[model samples]
Structure formats: C-alpha cells, structure tokens
Target chain A: MDKVGLEKHTSKQFDADLEDVRELVLAMGGLVEQQIADAVRALITGEGALGEEVVQGDTEVNRMEVEIDEECTRILARRAPQAGDLRLIIAVAKTITDLERIGDEAEKIGRMSTHLASYDRPKSAFYQIEMLGRHVREMLRDALDAFARLDSEAALRVAQQDEDVDREYEGIVRQCITYMMEDPRTIRHMLDVLWAVKALERIGDHSTNISEYVVYFVEGKDVRHIGLEAMEKEINEGAARRRGD
Target chain B: MDKVGLEKHTSKQFDADLEDVRELVLAMGGLVEQQIADAVRALITGEGALGEEVVQGDTEVNRMEVEIDEECTRILARRAPQAGDLRLIIAVAKTITDLERIGDEAEKIGRMSTHLASYDRPKSAFYQIEMLGRHVREMLRDALDAFARLDSEAALRVAQQDEDVDREYEGIVRQCITYMMEDPRTIRHMLDVLWAVKALERIGDHSTNISEYVVYFVEGKDVRHIGLEAMEKEINEGAARRRGD
Candidate 1:
C-alpha cells in the first residue's frame, strides 16, 4: 500500500480500537449500575431471586474487568501512545478496576439482602438505603458520562454528590443503633443492614474515584479528597474570569 | 564530550535520580512506622502528650508526600524514562500516597487515644486493640521492607499478614460490643475505640495496597485480592518444576 494509504489504515485501526474499548467500558459501567440498583431493590422488596442474580452476576463483571485490563495492556504495548491517548488508556484501566469493586460492593449488598430480608419488618430506614442507592447510581451515571465526554465539570459534580450519600449513610447507621438498643434481637440483623449500608457508601466512594479519574484524564491532575466546595469555587472563578466578572 | 561519554553521563544521572527518590521513600516509610509505634505506645501508656505529638508530627509526613510527588513528576517530565525506571517512579508516587494515608490513620488513633486516656479505665478489650495495632504495625513495616528491596515473596507475605490484622479487628469490635452492653455509660467511649481500631485495620489495608504495588512494580502484573494460599500453590509448583520433580 502507498504511504498515504498506510497512514489512513493505521488511523482507522486506532479509532476502531478506541471505540471498542469505549464500548467495553460503557458496558461494564451499565452492568455495575444495574447491579447496584438491583441489589438495593432486592433488599427493599425482599426479592430473593433478584438478590441471587446480582450476586451471581458479579462474576461476569469480574471477567469483563480482566478482559478490559488485558486489552489495555495490549494497546499500550503495541500503540506506544503518548499524552492524551495514554491518559485515556490509563483512565479506562483504572475506571474498570473501580467498576469491578463497585460490582463486588453490590454483590455484598445482595448477599446481605438475602439475610436481612428474613426480618419480620425491616426498620423504616430501608427508605434511606434506597435513597442512598439512588444518589450513588446517579453519581455513577454522571461520572461515566463525564468520562465518556472528558468533561471535568461533570466529573467534579459527581464527586460533590458523594457527600450526600455519605450523610445518608451516617443517618442510617444512627437509626440502626437506635433499633438495636430498643431490642437486642435487632442486633445481629441490624448489623447486617449496617454492613450492607457501609458497602453501599463505599460504592459511592468508588464512583467518586471514577470521577477523580475523569478529572485526571481531562486535566492531568489529581483532585481527589479535596473538598467539593473548593473545586466549585475554583471552577466558578475561572468561569467568572471568562465572563469578565 | 564524545557520544559514549555523554551517554554514560546521562545513565549515571538517571541512576542518581533513582537513588534520590528511593532514599526519600525510605525516609517517609521510617516516619510512618514511627507514627504507628507512637500511636500504639500512646494507647498502651495512656500518654496524652505522646498522642498529641503523633497527631502533630503527621504534618511532616503529609509535607513529605507532596515533596515526593513533586520529585516524581519532575523525573517523569525530564527523563521520560522507560521500564524499570518508570516502575520505580510510579511505585514511589503511589507508595507515598499510601504512606500519607497511613500517617492520617495513625493521627486518628492518636486523637482517639487522647480521648480514651481521659476515660476512667478503658472498659473494653484494650488488649485486643493493642494486638490489632501490633499486627498492623508489623504489616506496615514488612510492606515497606518488601517495597524497598522489591521482594515479591515479602510482599506476598505482607498481604497474607493482613488477614491476621482483620481477625484481630473483629475480636476488638466484638469485645467492644460486650462492654457497651454491660455499661451503657461506656457506649460512646467504646464506640470511639472501635472506630480507632477500624482505622488501624484500614491502615493495614493501605499497607496491603503498598505491597501489591511492589509486586506489580517487580512482576509487571497485578495479583491483588488473590489469596495467599493461591500464591503459595503457584510458588510451590514453580519450585517443583525447577527441580524437575
């Protein structure tokens, strides 16, 4: 083939590979989000079958994670990419790990659901768990969208949303303690709920991690654990400068 | 200078930079280990002053982490190193983050110790808390040693030791619950101890993370969360094959 044809073919191959990886990541994210939603729903609705499916489905997420990792390794070895391309590969690699862990957390919630469902009537705090799940699910979606678009602002927002999940987790824990104190029989069962809620909170943390990766990929900086207020202030100041405020 | 001389000079410069980074990591590790020791000692002796010192000294570890990160960034930008050099830089960058978090956990323990010291006779299983601290402190040191020498075997061992720390933490929490039930007055104080012990367990997790990074740097593969039994089986099989057994 002519040099121009060769160059064209190589760029086409690169684009195809990038798209393949993007699809894999989005698929993995979708599966993880589904897992979290189903796990929480299973607990709230006492659906044993749904909980079992979430638990069993985690193996598939784990398998996809290994495959994605292998693909990233192969791309890095063969493409010798630099700068933005390198950042994209690293982001996908790191995000997949976070996604897989989120899957595990969902599985944990599912397993706990099987145990907690046996309770005669769950403490009213099931509503809090459901709300926490909704918040984290939204964060996961936003984080993934930010990653797909390389949007730093969206990623920052997702990170900010994590605090709400954390606060809800705290409230649930306090409520569980009150129930445990009211009746000793509630101790073992309530502890399971506590663990499950803790796992869900950690899932929110992993979503924050995904957002941090999005920020890293887009800005080439680590903005993790820095308060959302500071992040918003900086971003708002930059926008104000652009608008001559 | 001739091409050969220039190449030799550049190589020496790379080696020197690598050593500088390595030495800094070791210094950070030493401080982290000392912080763990001081935190434990404060707990055992009820030394409020020592606990305060540990909390105050954590600022140094955080500053060191930033310095190490900056150094790694400069090396990567200036040298554009490959393979082993790349791994060394990446390991240092990641290990410092783990070390800094370890420092934070130790400070948390220190703060808890101050509060516990004020309480009249720590009613819970103080012994189990001490045991948890000892096991985690040992894990932290062994992880640092493994990383310093790039010893994959040592890293694997450190990962295995984490399970021991986890079991100790479980014991402490169980004992705390019993104490809280016996005397409601001790409830809040015992909960604080539980949180501090949980922090130590988390610090052990950070040590596991460091050990996993060491393994990755040395072997170019991730084996995190893989059981020690599986690692032992792999090693035994490799040994048998080498001996033509």
Candidate 2:
C-alpha cells in the first residue's frame, strides 16, 4: 500500500513485473501440483514408469525455483521497490520454496509409489486414497489461484478446504489400520499408503502456507497461528460470507 | 562483505540492531529446542501432565516470534540495513518461523501422547523412535549453535547427522509394521509411534533448514535443495583426506 518510490514509475513496468512474477509462480505451482497428482496416481494404478517420471519431473521444478529466485533478487536490486511490491517479491520467494518442498514431497511419494508397485500384495482400497490425492491437488490449485489474484477471500476459502483434506487423511489412516489388522499380508502396502497419505496432507499444509503468504502480501497482516475454525466462524458471521450456509 | 554505506554513524546503529536481533533469535531457538525435548520426553515417558505443559509452553514461543518480527520491522523502518545485515535479519525471521512451526509440531506430538495414554492399548516398542528423537533434538540444538556462532563447519556437521536420524526413522517404521502384523491389536499403538516418529523426522528437517540458514548467513551462499548426502560426503572427506582418499 505504501507506494513510496514506486509511484514515480509508469504503471506499465510495475504491472509487467508483477504479472511476470505471478505467472512464473503459478506455472511453478501447476507443475508441482501435477507432480503430486501423478505421483499418487502412479501409486494407485501401479504405474512404475509414471512414478519414475514424477521423480524426474522434480528437476524442472527445482530449476524453475532457482530462476524465480534470481528474478526476484534482480527485481529487488534494480527497482528497490517498497511495501506491496516488496511484499510481493518476498512472498514469491517464500512460496517458491514451499512449492519446491512440495515437489520434493511429491518425489518422495513417487518413490513410495514405485515401491508399492513392486509389492507382491496390494492394499484393496486404492480408490479412497486417490480421492484424498484429488482433494489435495484441488486445494493446491485453488490456493495458487488465490495467491495470483491476491484474493484474500479466496485464500481463506482454500484454508477452510484444508480441514476436509485433513479429515480424508484421518479416514485413510483408519482404513489402512483396518486393512492391516484383517490380514498381516497387507503390512507393506498399508505402510506405503500411510506415507502417501502423509505426503498429501503435507501438500495441503503447504497450500495453506501459500494462502497465508497471499494474505500477507495483500493485506500486510500475519494471520498465521490463528485457529482456522475460529477464522471460518468469523468469516461466516461477517459480510464476507457469500454462499455457504 | 561489501559495506557500501559504512561511513556514517547510522551504520553503527544498524549493526547494534542486528546484534540484538541475533541475540533474540538465539534465545528463541533455545526455548523452542527445550519445547521439542520436553515434548519428546512427554511422549516417551507417558507424562500426560508434562504433555499439557509442553502445549502450554508454545504460547511463549509464539510471543517470541511476534517480538522478533516486530524487531525486524523496526530495524527495517529505522536503519534500512543493507547487504549482510539485511540478509541476517531475513534469515533470522525465516528461522524463527520454522522454529515456531517445530514447536507447534512438538505440541501436536505431545497431544498425541496424551491421547495414547488415555487409550487402553499395548505400549509400542519406541526404542528406535526414542533414539531418533534424541538425534533430531541434538541436530536442532547444534544447528542453532552454528547459526549463533556462524560456524559453517558446525552447521555442516549437523546437516550430516540428519541422515542418521532419517535412517533410524526408517527402522522405527519397519519395526512398527512388524508389531502391527504380529498382533492386530497393536495397530493403534503402532500408529501412535508412527506419528511421533514422523514428528521427529520433521524436526530433523527443521534442523536442516536452520543449517541451511547458517550457510546462507555465513557464506552468503544458498546451499538449499542440494543433495544432503553429497554435501555430507564432501564435508566428511576432510581437506587432507581429499588428496589421498
């Protein structure tokens, strides 16, 4: 909000840089999110080749992360932007780190997928786990869109969606335990499911992180550590509520 | 290394402010590290009351994080520290965020321990998990010390030790699966151990983050996303040994 020195410049350069950074960030987010989806799909479908592809795809995400970092540094050094522009660059840097870690987690999931493909005995319930993966991927895309648009309301919505993914994770864990108890043969398969579920839950968390950064960049407020339920309750009570009953 | 504007007395004020920020960050690190240890102890010893204590202790960590943020903001507003001091503040701010999250994760583990204590289930064989917790705790403490001292050597050592903790975590997961298969009733207990072990592994990750920050703050080199095993190997193959072996 504090334009300071930035106001003197024509709006074209400012908008262009902002658009460029957002485009790069969203592109990075898309790749990382797809990687997560493919990684989980490889697990459920027993596609070892797909799993290997997800693992290899992480290199591109990592490379993009470095390029984004360099771009951010260059912007800061050259323009010396203040306040909102500063926050935007900072958010881009931090969110890219989160996105890269999401890529790493996705790669880990892919390796687990490869291992699960090799297991002689497979867990019977793959559909539910894939649903959970879809839930996480949707949340990630929503969070990334919210960040690019600087939509605080959209960001809060994504944060609310995290709880659903969390519940799905809990359900998967319970089901895995149930499966392992029914027969000892399901041990390795269930364990791999557990790891995969954990990775998806972590992806939800990172998406929430990107949302938090969005709120910070847009509003200049740190809303972290606040209880999500309380936040939703406040939003529902406030004029921000749109459709949900 | 480039002190671009050190001719004026304002630079001295910035340096002093940076020193204060560093001191506060170290203090916060000490408190968070203690919270981690206390949480692990509560889990291992089944100290429900201590678990409650650990959860309550997180408020202090949160307060310290806010204080650190305010201090950084004030320094940026007043002195506008450039180069190394600017990087140091940013690194400290990022480190505290990770540390606070570590505290929150530890609190979650504590809460899980309390839940485990309430359930009438067979106890898990947490020997490997306990070792993993110890390794993570030491890595965290050492990494913070390295940050405070700006000792890349010490940070590298802590980074190298993370692999040991990770290996121990794998061992615990395997052991948990073995227990769950031997008796279906052990599934709940095994899940508890799994959650705790995962928390410890995340703690190890945060230590790695702190070490990376040390590398950045000391060397001004972002060694993040580099292969940890390769870095450890390079570090361990000492200067003299590098020529011969």
Candidate 3:
C-alpha cells in the first residue's frame, strides 16, 4: 500500500479502538445507573431481594471496569496515541475507576437497604432518603450522558447539581439527628439511614468526578484541585468559545 | 553522533526524567503525610488554628499533583516509554491522584476539626478518633515508603493494614451512635466525629489504592476489584514463586 493508504489505516484503527472503549464505558455506566436506581427503590420499598440484586450486579460492573482498563492500556502500549487520543484514553481509564466506585457505593446502599428492611423505619427519614437518592441518580445519568456526547456544558450542569445533593444530604443528617435525639429507640435504624445517605452523597461526588473527566477529555485541561466556582467559570468560558466558533 | 551514542543518551535522559517524577511524588507524599498528622492532631486537640494550617497546605499538594501529571504526560509524549517504564509512569500518575485525594480528605478532617472545636467535648469519642487517625496515618506512611522503594511486599502489607483501619472506623461509628443515643445534646457533636472518622476511612481507602498501584507497577498485574483475600493470595503466590527462583 502507498503512504496515504497506511496512514489512513492507522487512523481508522485508532478510531475503532476508541469507539470500542466508549461503548464499553457506556455499557458500564448504564449498568451502574440501574444499580443506583434499584438500590434506592429497594431502600424505599423495604425490598431486600431487589437490594440483593443490586449487590450482585456490582460484580459485573467490576468486571467491566477491569476489561475497560485493560483495553486502554493495550491501546496506549500498541498505538502510542498522542494529544487528543491520549487524553481520551486517560479520561476513559479514570472515568471507569469512578464508575466502579459508584457501583460500590450503590452496593453499600443496597446492603444498608437490606439491613433497614428488617427494621421498622422512620417515615420522614425514609422520604428524605428517597428524594436524595433520586437527585443523585439524575446527576449520575446526566454525567454519563455528557461523557457520551462529549458535552462540556452538560458536564458542567451535572457538576453544579452536586451542591443540591450536598444540601439534601445535610438535611437528611439533621433529620436523623433529630429523630435519634427525640427517641433513642430509633437510633439504630436512624444510623442505617445516615449511612445510606452518606453513600448517596458519595455517589454524587463520583458523578461530579465523571463530569470533571468529561471537561478534561474535551478541553485537555485539569480543572481539579480548584474551587467549584473556578471550575464553573472555566466550563462557562469553554462553552462561550464553542458558541463563538 | 553515531546511532549507539544517540541511543545511550536517550536512555540516560529517560532515567533522569523518571527520577524527577519519582522525587516529585515522594515530596508530595511527604506533604500529605504531614497534612494527615496535623489534621489528626487538630482533631484530637481541638485546635482550630492547626486545622486551618492543614487546610491551607492542601493548595501546595494540589499544585504538586498538577505539575507531576503534566510531567508524566510530557514524558509519555516525548519518550514513548514502554514496558516497565510505561507502567511506572502510569503508576506514578495514578498514585499522585490518590495522594492528592488523601490530602483532600485531610483537609476535610481539618474543616471538621475547626467546626467541632466550637462544640462541647466528648472525651471518649476524641480518644477513639485519635487511635483510628494514628493507624491510618501509619498506613499512609507505609504506602508511600513502599512506592519510593518499589517494594511490592511492603505495598501488600499496607493493603492488609486497611482492614484494621476499617474495623477501627466501624468501632468509632458504633461509639458515636451510642453517644448520640445516650445524650441528645451530644448528638450534634457526635455527628462531627462520625464525619471525621468517615473521612479517615476514605483516606485508608486511598492508601489502599496507592498500594495497589505499587503492586501493579512491580508485578504488571491488576489486583483491584478483587477481594482482599484474593489480592493477598496473589501477592503471596508471587512471593513464593520468587523464592523458588
């Protein structure tokens, strides 16, 4: 083949490899999102069986993470991709780690849900947990979607959503404190609620992490270790530049 | 210059670059270790000023993380290092991330210490936190030492230590629950302790992550997503095989 033919072949192969990584990542994200939703439902409905399913489902997420990581390493070793391609590989690798941890957090919630199912619960605390869970699940969904689309604007929106989740989490913690203070008998069950909310809060954090990776992948910038306000400003400026283009 | 001389020069340059990255990582590790120590001291002593210093020190850790990451990327792009060199770079990049997160967790403990300083004391709770914090700090130190020496065995030892930290964390949580149940007024103060222990537990996790990276760098294996029992078994088998040689 001529020089152009060989160049085209190499580029095509790199594209195909990247596409494979993306598909695997999306599949893992979809599984994790379901795990979060099912875990929350199990918590609210007091269904231990569904919670068990979420816990069992985590093994698959873990497997997907390992597979995706291996693929990224293989590409990096074989192709020695540079610039945008290197950034994408790094982002995908880091994103899967976050996804796997999200799955683990969901599994923790599932376990807590199973434990809580055996106890007589507080109605208001359960309601707050359900609401917080819904918010975090939405954030995860949006973060994954932004990653799939390479949409920094959508990613920034998801990052901003974390503050709302944090607020809701604080509210739940305060309510749990009140419940425990009013009736010591409820302390044991309230502890479970507290732990579940902590897991939900962590899920929100992992989602924000995913959004940060999306920004990094798209812009090749490291926005981490900076304040949220600075991150938001950077994302907004990137969006404006895209519009100007 | 001849081809042989050029190859020799390139190898020397690569070694120098690797050494530089390693030195930066160790320096960052030292800063993080100090942060953890200071944060724990502040938590136990109820010195808000020390906590503020730890929080402020996180900026330096963050800057180091970014600089190290950029250096890794530059080396990858310019050197196209392979095999062990490639794995070492990847491990350093990933390890620095976990170290930065450990710093963030320390900063969180610092902030909680600042807040809890304003509250009335729970003597026994503080004691338990102190014990747990010391264990986790030791684990961080061992993990960093393992990385610096490229000692996979030491890394495995550090990974094993995380279980003890987890058990200690659970004990602290249980004590906090009991305190909250016994005295309604102490519930608020106890919650602060709970969050700090939670942060400490997370720091242990990040420490485990660094250890796993050490194992990966040495053995070229992925031991994560697997249970600790399995990881220990793998490391032991590897050790046994080495002995047979």
Best candidate, lDDT? 3
Off by over 4 Å in 1: A1-19, A47-57, A64-66, A73-80, A233-245, B1-10, B41-104, B107-117, B121-124, B233-245
Summing lDDT over every window of 10 consecutive residues in candidate 2 chain A, give the lowest-scoring window.
A1-10
Question: Each candidate's interface RMSD, rounded to one decimal?
Answer: 3.8, 2.4, 1.3
Go through the candidates in order and give the clash count of each.
0, 0, 0
Best by DockQ: 3
Q: How accurate is candidate 3 locally (lDDT)?
A: 0.85
Report the lDDT tens digits of candidate 2 across residue range A21-106: 88999999999988998998898888999999999999999999978976876676556667677777778877998899899889
TM-score of each model, paired residue for residue: 0.81, 0.87, 0.93
State the lDDT of candidate 1 residue by residue for B1-245, as single tens digits. Answer: 00001012357877788888888999999999999999988876789899999999998998888678768766765676666566666667768877987998899889988987877655347776777788888888899888777776787788888888888888877876776676655655765676688789989988998987776666555565466777656544544554569
The C-alpha RMSD in Å for every predicted model, in order, reads 6.4, 5.1, 5.1
Please give the lDDT score at residue A92 for candidate 2.
89
> How many collisions between residues are there in candidate 3?
0
For model 3, how does the per-residue alpha-carbon lDDT over B1-245 read when each residue is reduced to its tens digit? 00001012357778888889989999999999999999999999889999999999999999999999899988888887787788888899889889988999999999999998877777887888898898988888999888887777888899988888999999888888777777878877777778888999999999999999988887678888787788777777666665674
Q: Taking the tens digit of each residue's C-alpha lDDT, what string does model 1 give over A1-245?
A: 00001012357788678778878999999999999999999988888788999999998998888788768656665565566666677678778878988998899899988887767656479888888889888999999988777677788888888878889989988887777677655666776787788888888888998998876666666555456777666555544554568
Native-contact fraction for each model? 0.00, 0.46, 0.63
The TM-score of predicted model 1 comes to 0.81
Candidate numbers, best DockQ first, in rank order: 3, 2, 1
